[model samples]
Target chain A: AQSVTQLDSHVSVSEGTPVLLRCNYSSSYSPSLFWYVQHPNKGLQLLLKYTSAATLVKGINGFEAEFKKSETSFHLTKPSAHMSDAAEYFCVVRGNNQGGKLIFGQGTELSVKP
Target chain B: AAGVIQSPRHLIKEKRETATLKCYPIPRHDTVYWYQQGPGQDPQFLISFYEKMQSDKGSIPDRFSAQQFSDYHSELNMSSLELGDSALYFCASSFRGGPAPDTQYFGPGTRLTVL
Candidate 1:
């Protein structure tokens, strides 16, 4: 079984400040991790994915996340937060077994304050 | 190119009535998935179809069923609607049976409300 947990339900950060959203996962095998963003009244858009090649993954809109195996965490971060960055973020994990199904975190609502 | 497309962007149904949602995956994609998202929550997997075969099903009830067509288009049927079933339903697709990592592309979603 695989599962993901987003540490924060809501995170607020000022524009131009750094942003961090934490996530932890439990997977039986080497899992493929992903970060997705959902804007208001829109579908989910992929931010980035970690397929065991790189520990640090860069995504669109100046967002990035580091896959930490030992810590069992894949935390999303951005150097400077923009007002457009305000959205709901989800951390997902897919198992390497047969019939791979994505397990999603509870989600984190990011609010960028100006 | 267009991503996954879903029909009936919004729907309202009475309790005990049936509700059907449709999805059209991107051309050439062999996998399609259905998910349900509740208010202020993450999307929950319902079922997945790969090459017109049922691959995986999650914790949804038996009233929820899905089918896939030869062209990879899919439909989700709910036998009897319930108030709890009111939520946003999303359709996703991905390329399967390849070396490429499985990345799902999602549709705008259908908002279903049961009265």
Candidate 2:
């Protein structure tokens, strides 16, 4: 079974400061990882994805995640936090045997303070 | 670029009632996926369709059924609604022949409230 675990349930960061959201996965084989963000009462938006081509993946809104195989981690980071960055983030793993069903983490609520 | 579209952005229903949710994939998109998200919870995959055929399913209740139409649109039919079924339902679409075939674009989602 492929699953993702988000280390933090909530993370607070001041505007212009660095932000980090940690995630780890357990998979029997190589996995396709993804980061998705959802604003209040809004649809989820894809932030980034890792398909094994590159360890470092860049995404929309100045976000990026590095897939570290040894650590079984794919942590999202931003050089600077903006107020609009406040939202819920989910780490997802696509099941290899389930026709690409996404297994999601519990989610990390990001709070960007101005 | 056009994105996925879901109907009935908000819905209120009573227990034991049935409901239908519709989804329209983006132009040229042949794959559709559905998910359910409870309050303050991560979304869970419910089902998926590829080329108008059932492709995958996960955590979907027996009372819930879904199908993709010939036009490539999809519908989810949920029956015997319970309070636990009150949640946000999302529809996503992707083009299998596109460069980024695996990338899914999500819709705004339908918020269903069962009373």
Candidate 3:
């Protein structure tokens, strides 16, 4: 069984400040982790993915996440928050099974304050 | 770069009616996945197809069936639709020829509303 948990349901940060969204996971097999951002009425956009290669993964729009096996965590972060960065963030874990389904976390809604 | 494509961006149906959703994978992509997302909910994996074959199954309801065609396009058919079935249906495509953990690109999901 594979599962992901996002620690925060909502997070607010001021513009130009640092941002963080916490996530954790449990998987029987070595897992593949991903961060996806969904804007209002829009499709999910892949931010970054961790495939056991790099622990610190860099994504588009200056976002990044660190995959910590010991902690079973993959937290998304950014140095500076922009207005456009506000969206719903999902932490996803890919299943090791044949179909490779993606198990998503509950989601963390990020709000950027001006 | 081409991304996955889905049809009927929005749909409305009455209870017990049937609905069909279509998906076209990216060029040369060998795998396609379907996910359902309810309001303010995370996307839930429904099923996946690899090389036109059913590769994995998830929490998909028995009333729903999906298949990948020879052209790599797929269709998800739902029968006896219920209000609970109203959600955003997303189709994702990935190329599995290279390595493990292929990145799946998502399409603009179809918003299905059942009245």
How far is B44's C-alpha from truth in model 3 (Å)? 0.7
Query: Each candidate's interface RMSD, rounded to one decimal?
Result: 0.9, 1.2, 0.7
Name model 1 segments beyond 4 Å from true: none
For all predictions, the C-alpha RMSD in Å is 1.1, 1.0, 1.0
Please write out the lDDT profile of model 1 over residues B1-26, one tens digit for every residue. 87899999999999999999999998
lDDT of 1 by residue, A1-114 (tens): 889999999999999999999999998878899999999988899999999889999999999999999999999999999999999999999855555678899999999999
Candidate 3 lDDT by residue in tens digits, A15-43: 99999999999998788999999999999
Cα lDDT tens digits, model 2, A2-29, are 9999999999999999999999999998
* Candidate 2, true inter-chain contacts retained: 0.77
Q: List, in order, the clash count of every candidate structure.
A: 0, 0, 0
Tell me, by lDDT, which candidate is best: 3
Tell me which of candidates 1 and 2 scores higher on lDDT.
2
Error of 3 at B105 (Å): 0.8
Rank list by lDDT: 3, 2, 1
Regions of candidate 3 where Cα sits further than 4 Å from its true position: B99-101
Rank the candidate models, highest TM-score first: 3, 2, 1
